[model samples]
Target: MRRFDSAQPILAGLVSAVVGYASSFTVVLAGLRAVGATPAQAASGLLALCAGIAATAVFLALRFRMPISIAWSTPGAALLVATGHVQGGWPAAVGAFLVCAALIVVAGLSPWLGRAIAAIPRPIAGAMLAGVILSLCTAPVRAVVDVPALAIPVVLAWAVLTRFARQWAVPGALLAAVVAIAVRGVHLTGVSIAPAAVLTVPTFNLPALISIAVPLFLVTMAAQNVPGMAVMATYGYTPPLRGVLVTTGLASAFAAPFGGHALNLAAITAALTAGPDTHPDPRRRWVATAALGAGQLTLGLGAGLAMALVLLSPPVLVIAVAGLALLSALGASLASAVTDPSGREAAVVTFVVTASGTTILNIGPAFWGLVAGGLTALLLYRRTRPSSPPDPTPPSPAATELPSPTAAGPAASR
Candidate 1:
């Protein structure tokens, strides 16, 4: 009993890592591929991301003695898929990755830049995220129509497990996808399981920078890092913001040449390790994230195998799993995008433009969406502003008077 009790946090950490990795790896792979990474380069990117996430999680957890979970930016990956191929190919995308990492570092070092990011209106941010992921989120439905034999079982498994074991739903779906792929028989003749990294000489181009780097940075900061801090706060833990941003930024830089796009603080997975459910004593929760590091390291060793499986499997099946993984995020983003009546129009404009996936002047839709939303918000707000301040009238005695204790209701009496 004593041994099992001590192992709880460790087990929770492992579970968190597994859930985090299995949930959206396909999104990462698809994103890398869509941006022009070859199969080997994409596999390398996955490996690099796993390594960066593991190193960051373990170091932060131990150094801070807090459950500071780290993760690859999943929404950023979805944004990549939406952006599609860049002008300068994989190397240019890599340069964009480097630029994003530098921006993250600067955001940490410069208070003004951090504030600027925070100043990006929440509704616009949420709407942009929603739009970027809209198509990917619909891939499961498309998969059902295109490949029922492979897709149906995966969806059913995810749906059933979501009803009973919510955290395991995506992993279960991934497992089902693997089973379906194996049964369907895929050729894996020359695929290698040994982990390896492929270096690309990064080249900078205006198109890639505007199309990929800027939007990727925005999505990662808004969707992952900010929410990650909020999750820690919810668990009564104050993360080391400067340390986290700098460390993750540096790690992302290290992995960028190997094709990893970005790494950031984990939000959804952080809750698994940081919450009271992981350990009754809050102080012990850091052990869970430490264990998560180990789990990620172990998984990193198998990146080649994972990528091989993904490459060999039917494209629609893997895409369907990625779509299923993002459904919850999409729902949350949409809700947040339209939650405030004042910002609803701007948010809707952002969403429509982003979902359209149109490019103008070589820049992607995500950037244009923000521009449109920001302009709409400015116009609407300026038009609605009062010409003069309202008079500060005093309240009447009757209006200001408190209700009787009895009239206040039963709870008030108690």
Candidate 2:
């Protein structure tokens, strides 16, 4: 069952995984571009994100009998944008990662963050999500302005097609946008082939750890991992958290040598892989996620090809596809934000601050945006926010929920 024999979830996993992977490419690329990552930095970040996602999906699938794709929180990416443009190069960035990773590992291993996740009111989570999605949707809006001559007709067509024909929304909207905006004569150029060699050496440069390690870790946890787990919880899987963190960490440790950075739980992406839309049997979804892993290996085994595609692919294609893919999520988030009368103001604050991309000091707007929203909800709208009221201090369970040194985890299970 652990090996290739587990093929039941293949059909659903395939479709969702394809869409998930494609949409993620847009996210990683857009974030990297915003941070002004060098070609190598961009490549490294992408590889880390992809490899981290694939490996996590496989682990969660096998562990929980469901499809799980651990994805980076694009919100986290928003947080790290400033770091990329900061004074330090890759070395400093590495330091930042170590810090971030340590924080996450502690959160996962300890009961604090875990309890927080469980305690957070469902409505608040929904509001936070709305804020996050609203922040990302603005990408397309700005992209449209940046390239209006081409963007105008494309976006107009997307609106018309999606408005008039609901079922034909995503693919149709994307098709119209990409085709209309793309310049002709653009095609894949030949790439150099490199021998497939497994790399295990991560040039441990301690000096730069402050910069690289912290930012990566921060974004990974707050943005990527938290949401990954949330998505799983939203779907009601509920796997072990510690194991998921450790495994993703291991994946990151291994892949770091190959230019991968922080890997963590995938929230938004897992929904794609684990939904009924992915497969009927929860036990079979692993196949679809496994397929995603294979794709990552392909990209790794063909690094030059990966880099070339990143370079050659039209920016318009990325924006158009990404915008359409995120459209549904954005709508869902926005709806959730305002659904509760009490949370309306807080949610609006989240949407505006986040969408503004304004930073507080060096911290990215996403983090501050969340902090701002949470505080406001607590202070101003305390009456409305569901009272988690200190866990009714019940007698402790006779035995902890652990196997005798065994039994184990997912952001996928969030």
Candidate 3:
């Protein structure tokens, strides 16, 4: 078992949990509603997602001795919001969730599929992610115009907190929202304190399977899981990818019956736990993720209350808070997509197509965005791709000893 010498990791974990749960929760609620979920079912979905992410984060961090942060797929939730009220409603959405989970499990089990996911062009992935969240990102301005009294205070709090305590910016904004709503007498008439889980039987529908499942799976993988892995690599922690994928996929499957959509490696919060700020020693950083898991579990117990708060507030106001929370992620994605000049045009095309909200063949813009961007990149950038230069430096001592992914177990697959 690992122990921490300082409490900084614990604090970081706490902040990560707060930000993770608070920032995108409205999006989750909106997604559930778009899929025709009742308020109770949406609350159940929140609980299930929090439970799944907590369990996976704790288990993987302990088992692998690595900082592994797990979270609900916000981009997948956004895709659900975009899909909006399929034929079979919430049950069909549940079925789509199950399908996505199964696909993730397959990807974990099959090295080729995992490699294929990894092979997706970074610019395309970033663009698709950017597109998914575009609507929510624009809500803040609309909210301010519609209800300046509520939106301005929350935005101001976010801006102020971002300057002083960057990690607490979203949480502070959320607190401001709560105060504003309450002060305005937004009564929580039917809100309940007791949390309860509700099980939903899945109803399979082909339209949802195509529009919701496929796109959700792709966005979750490309936007969240892939970036999460890259963040871990930046911290020099080479976790076993197969183990991670399998764990998260199983967690997602477990939560589906309770209405949770998708769970996977976390991109934003992973930085908090994996960085030197958590702990100077890389080996000890897993404790931060363990702490994060615990925090998530604690918060999960209050899903009913959280949902009630969201329900009591005006929809646009909740949306405005969500938009504020997602701004950082949106900026990061856009920056990543255009950072390379070679892929800039393709990335821009992908972003525009995705943001356009144009659906074709019952499929959402995300899928088409990827296809269009991929084709553009292939046509324009293929010739410009620099051929691998011959290595002038000798291989490191560890290079020959390191096994390929198949032999290395999980890490090789990643």
Candidate 4:
């Protein structure tokens, strides 16, 4: 009983890592490919991400004695898929990754930059993210229309499991995709199962920086890091903002040469390890994140095999799985996008431009979406003066106090 009790947090950590990796790895691979990485490079990118996640999670958990879960930026991957190939191809994209990493570090050191990011209204940020992922979210329906025989089984598996076992739905869909590939008689020949890292010398170009780096930075910060902090805070943990930003930014920089795009705080999966469900005592929760690091290291060893399976399968089927995985994120983004009446028009404009996949002056629609939305808000949104003077009464202590954990509600799913 003692041994089993001690192992609970470890098991929770492992579960969190598995769920995080399985749910969105296809998106990572697809994003790498979209940015012109070859099969080998994409596999390398996956391996690099796994290594970074493992190293950073373990280091932070141990250093802070807190459950600080780290993850590859899923929405950033979706943004990559939307942006497609850019100038200087994979190398340029890599350069953008490094540039974004520097920006993250700068944001940590410079309060002004951090404030600038925070100044972007939540609705606008949410709308931009919604636009970025809209196309990829539609891939499932397109897959069914284009390849029903393979796509239908995957969709049905995801749907059924989503209704009954939401956490396992994406993994179940991936399993269905694998079975479909086998049934289709697709043979994997000359596939390398050993993980290997291939480094590409990054080339900086204006187009990739504007198109990929800025949007990727915004999505990572708004969608992942900020919410991750809130999730931890909800559970009564205060992670050091500067340390986390610098650590993850450095990790991302180290992995960029190997094709990994970005790494940030884990929002959705943070609950698994940070909440009391992982362990009755909050002090022991860090052990669970350390176990998560071990699990990610184990998964990193199989990156080559995972890449091989993805490469051998029908593209649409894999895409269908990626689409299903992102459905929840899309729903949450859309909800946040239109929640404020004042920002509704700007958010809608952002979403439409992003979804349209337009490119002007060799820059992707995501950057343009922000520009259009900001302009729309500037021209249309006007603050009216109050009809009377403001009240001067001070708030009660209870009103100023933070909510209890039970009342904090669940963190936004990434």
Candidate 5:
């Protein structure tokens, strides 16, 4: 018997995995390299991330009996890319990764921490995410300007595909990019096919912990996990927040020694599996998420191949494809951040400061963006707001005046 009566769910799952993987793996690779991972180690890290998230997604879906999709922290990867070289190199980065995982675990176990994270204003969160992805979203334009011949076809393909099959746009663009790269005779020489797990003995560094781990944890929670829960809620499936957090945290820790930075609830791809289009019956959508996990696992096994393929491409091409993938996410975040008049200024401030790439006291722009936005919002809104009376509770039926039953009785009428 088929696990799911409808194949739509299964198909949706497969597509989610493909789109998710193809979209952001380059960013992961670039981030790992920036943090001092050798090419071989970076490949191992990518594989470990895929495997860890795959396992986490499967476990969470089965445990919760919901379509809870898990994903690597793309925003966190972008953070790492922005941070570049740290004080202790890759070993220190590994230590920071472990710290991030531990923090996530604590957030899961401690109600106070979870509440604190949840208390973050939605506008600030959206703006911070938008800022983080701003650079990435510009890659398409830069790539086109830098290499028109290679980028134009990919962009055109994405535009055409998006018009028809919106879901397949990114992957379609990626296919076009691959063809463009191949036609240009990009050499594949010197690319290694061997997939080896390179373990880094983590070295504790306070600077790395403060800079990388703190920002990573914040971004993963605010940008990915929080919105991920919203996505699930949209489909009326509310999985336990703690369980999801703990599962992804442990997975991130497990993969850290081999190069993975962080894993969390997936926001973008979750829609593919959780939406009504996946299946008419929401109860059976877990099968689609499971299929997604299986697909991710299969791709994880081919991490070496993925690494080789990426290595063969020019950096511009890789980033351009990645930019195309993130355009939708960027647009959505911007729209959401400024949708409300109350928070518009704060959100814009957050977006500008974060996108500015400013670092203060060794902390990155993302952290500062949230702080500035929150403070600005508090100050701005408090000054202009008028005092209002508290709403009164409604009267109970027994307390309210009503027509007496005796007055309407048949005996009285007679």
Candidate 6:
């Protein structure tokens, strides 16, 4: 068993767990509600999703030589919300979960897919990532339209502070928004607040997989997995793609019955573990991912208490906190996307398309954003430099032989 000398993995894991869970949970709740989940059902379902990500984050991060954290697919939420509206019930969504899990596992195990992931140009991948985040960044703003007096100014204030102040922008903006909401006396009077109960047993049936399981699986993979690995690579942590996919698959496979539809590598949550804040030695920090699993277990056990807290907090708080928490990550990706002169235009196109929230055939924008960005990169940046590839050879546990992801490509498929 491999391990690191620094205590940073443990420290990073603790912080990453709390911040990532809280932020991602908000999205998960939105996802449940979008699917018309009862308030208690929504809380329990989000807890399950967190449980899945936390498990994968810990297992894969510990085994792989990178700070590999997992996260829920926020983009998938948009797709599922639409899916829930059309599909008739949660059974179809669960079916999507099962199918997506199978797909994720298959993709993880397949070397061709891993090769394909690695082959994508950095500029294109960066653009796709920006596209994903930009969409999420704008969600709070658009939510205001649903509750204009409430969601609008909160988003606008966040934008203004972010544009003007820069450093303290996200936190400050979130705080300001919270204060604004409070001043206006917007309370959750109609919202249900009773403690949520957990569904210990998973609901399963073959027919349900078709309507709910398959699409949810596709949405999770398209929206979450590909872009997440990109973020890991962007920051220079190159863990095995096979390991991650397998972990995500296992997580979802287990979580699906519990109504956790989407669980994969978390680009946003990963920033906490992948950045300079985690560890100077990339190899040392993978343990932190494992720690997240521990955190998930902790959260799962006390979900009733967690729901109590959520019921009390304002909706704007969730958006503002998530927006702020992701600001650093968002900036880093945007910087990566446009820094290369050749890839600049393609990246911009990717960002705009993703941010647009336009859907085709009910598929969300992340898929199209990646498609558009990849095509643009293909057309504009034809001269892609493929550095010396990793030796397509047998495994070695010794640290030196482990090729850096940036040095070679995304994780080598099994």
Tell me the deviation in Å of residue 340 in model 2.
Answer: 3.2
What tens digits encode model 3's per-residue C-alpha lDDT throughout 1-414? Answer: 245457878888888998899878888888888788998999899999988888898999889999999999987887777667776788988999999999999998999987787777676778878887889889899989999999999999999999998878888899999999889987767678567789999999787788788888888888888889899999898888888888999999999989899999999899989998888888888989999999998898888988899888888888888788778778988987776555666788899998888877766677778888878766564443337763689868876443322322211112
lDDT digits (tens) for residues 1-414 of candidate 5: 255557888889999999899878888887888789988889999989988977987887788789999999988888887777788899999999999999999999999998777666666778887888788788889889999998999899999989998878888888888888889987767787677788989998777887789879988998899889999999999999988888889999999999999999999899999999888889989988898999998888777777777778777777788778778778878887877655677788899998998877766677788778878776665554436653488757774442232322212211
Tens digits of lDDT, candidate 1, 121-236: 78889999999999988999999999999999999999999999999999999999999888888767898878899999999999999999999999999999999999999999
Please, what are the lDDT tens digits per residue for candidate 2 over residues 1-414? Answer: 443335545544555544445444555555555544555555666666666767676766667665567655554443344334433544344444445555567766888865755544333444444454454555567767676655566567667766895434454544555455345444554543342323333333443343345435544654466667678777767767787777777666554554445677666557766666655666565566776665554454444444455465456545555566567656666666666555555666666766665545545555555566667556554343335654556636653321111111111112
User: Candidate 6, after superposition: displacement of residue 83 in Å?
Assistant: 4.1
Measured on C-alpha atoms, candidate 2 has an lDDT of 0.55
Q: What is the TM-score of each candidate against the true structure?
A: 0.93, 0.67, 0.87, 0.92, 0.87, 0.62
Report residue 177 deviation for candidate 2 (angstroms).
Answer: 6.8
Evaluated against the true structure, the overall lDDT of model 4 is: 0.89
- Residues 236-286, candidate 6: write the lDDT tens digits: 867777777887887877876666767777766677777777777776767
Candidate 4, run of 10 with poorest lDDT: 405-414
Model 6 stretches with alpha carbons more than 4 Å out: 1-7, 82-84, 112-153, 156-197, 200-219, 231-237, 296-414
Which 10 consecutive residues of model 6 have the lowest summed lDDT? 405-414
Q: Give the lowest summed-lDDT range of ten residues in model 1.
A: 405-414
The models' CA-based lDDT, in order, is 0.90, 0.55, 0.84, 0.89, 0.83, 0.61
Give the Å shift of residue 386 in candidate 1: 4.2
Q: Give the TM-score of candidate 6.
A: 0.62
Model 4: CA > 4 A from native:
382-414
Judged by whole-model lDDT over C-alpha atoms, candidate 1 comes out at 0.90
Collision pairs in model 1:
none
Candidate 5 has a TM-score of 0.87
